[model samples]
Target: MTASPSSAYPYRLRLPGPITIPERIRQATARSIVNHRGPEMRVILEEIQQWIKPLFGTTAPVLTFGSSGTGVMEASLANVLAPGEKVLALVHGQFGERYAQIARALGAEVDVIESEWGWTPDPAVIAAKLDKNDYRALVAVHNESSTGAVTDLAAIGALLRDRDTLLLVDSVSGLGGLELRQDEWGVDIIVTGSQKALMCPPGLGFASVSEKARKVIERDDRCARFYLDMRKALAVVDKHETAFTCPVSLLFGVHEALTMIHEEGLPQVFARHKRLSDAMRAGCVALGLPAFGDQATASHTVVVASVPEPLTGGAIVKHMYETYNTAIAGARNKLTGRVIRIGTMGLISEADVLTDLYFLERSLTALGHAVPTPGCGVAAAVASLS
Candidate 1:
């Protein structure tokens, strides 16, 4: 079982989504709801389009939804796949499997290139599969939150540069934190949520569609969908309106979040996530908790580390919450008692990373797991940051 947040009013949310929101963003959400189709809403929508495009690395239309990341994931597939259409899914972790499952549920004949939980799918292996099959599209996850493993989208994108097969990417935990050049990478569709590195709440999903994907969306009527229909969303967004009544207050928060992202500049945001991830990994290793995945391909958004023997991941997670009032994450599926996840995305700072490491070292010690040296974890993290 995971650590319960039942004891506190505001335990530091160190999860992939629903992360700690900054005061400006929280205040943005508290603003009164506006008319979803009014002039003010139009202006907000226009501004969001202007700001969010660079984050997706796309100049194409980026659609918004009144749903979570999964909704846009579904939308990306729905707009392109037809009944019994063959699709290739590169599965490394849970979220990658979820994307494939969504395709299967849509009646597509889903084929998967499965990799171990802690590793990402090899681009060469993916190329071999592409050579063997005439898939309608290839599905991939930009960052797998479950295992904290990041797939090399740029490499995968290069593999499909001249192919007819579309590349649909699930960038849920990656967009604002990692490097993504959607158009340059030749990705057809890119899906993400506002809750992750975007530093907003969980009610909004965004998708950037390339001209090729838009052409498929415009021509395909096989997948029956209403709320997730990209055609309708595209038509209205061009008018600076929504196809349906959007979550007005949540969009307000998203607007504020995007404003902040632009102000800091995307390069600096990516650099910050890199620094924090490096620090977290260094600190964990110093505490005898090495990273769970391959270091070369590990995620910079969420850091996954192994828990030493005789100490359960859940125990340390619970201890962190109960003892320090801070929340970390436990593993899923096969990794369940062995690993802990630390989120280093939006609104998280160096101080937060150091404090988390300090408390984590204490928690491990309190749970009867000995560290190499007292204060060494924080010291290693500080050194990494420098």
Candidate 2:
């Protein structure tokens, strides 16, 4: 009999993520299953709790759940902000809107400050709004992956300082790849996933809650959610445990990934991302392709460039996969057919970026799309490493 389809390697990917995983992390996660509540699991959870705090830059309570980043989005609004309270959602792209949606669904009155599709939220705009109104909390996405822009967190955070209002951030794609200081930045709640910068498969959602946010969670009696309740989770965490069945394998992967990040040193990791991002954009410039958003606010974790005339992003995505054995992403939601995206996170090396660009140049040329400047794309990209 022929081999099963699952037996073969799927797409050869250079995704905007769930990107490639490292060998060491894969090996660590492959161990035989262990009892979720046993002593073995206890050791793992405790270790993760201590280690993950540094990444978050939080001395506050950092919690892990076996759900996606959206889960924490729900938990944050549901547990802390009471019904009928007002929340200001600063939205630039898709993920920022997601924060507002979750808050609205959970009964908080959402006041949204929206910008153009490819523009990041102006901290000045948000600050002006704050001065005129009283809000229970401010919700923002640290990185807007869909439009490839990053919000100004430092400016936003500074505005909220020492105030009654709390700050919630979705750092789903930024946490492990970018520099985020939870406590220093005065971010009350920060959430992320294992799939993005952490260099692991999707399954784990990590969040950090400040003492001020925890008190709000503790006192909210009107809406009692058991499964995703921060207080309930924290009680068990006190014993280094989970309130529900956890993904044991994913926990292992997260631990190893975090260990690898610290070993490399965060400063080095950050510098590497900056280099790769600059190179990717330079390549885009060389190819005469416009990136989706403003360069000033572009994300360090993702790059989105406009597809030239005579081809949609989806078509190019397909062509690149079939003809070149690579997989980058096409646009999603409102931006579909307009732009192509590349992930610059989680084990994607400078060399990998170069290889992807080389093939990208070839694929675009194969599609009858002329390279604006022959060899310019690769040259500018390669120079960024030096």
Top-TM-score structure, candidate number: 1
lDDT of 1 by residue, 1-386 (tens): 55455464346788767689899999999998888899999999999999999998989999999998999999999989888999999998889999999999999999999999889988889999999989889999999988888888888889998888899999999989998999888999999998899888888999999998888899856599888999999998889988998999989999999899888988999999999999999999999998887788888899999987899999998888877788788977778989999899997888999989988999999999888899999999999999
TM per candidate: 0.96, 0.94
Instruction: In angstroms, give how far residue 372 of model 1 lies from its true place.
Output: 0.7
Question: How well does model 1 score by local distance difference test?
Answer: 0.90
lDDT of each: 0.90, 0.84
Pairs clashing in candidate 1? none
User: Which residue pairs collide, candidate 2?
Assistant: none
Name the 10 consecutive residues with the lowest summed lDDT in model 1: 1-10
Compared with the true structure, the alpha-carbon lDDT of candidate 2 equals 0.84
Candidate 1 residues lying further than 4 Å off, grouped into runs, are 1-10
Clash counts for all predictions: 0, 0
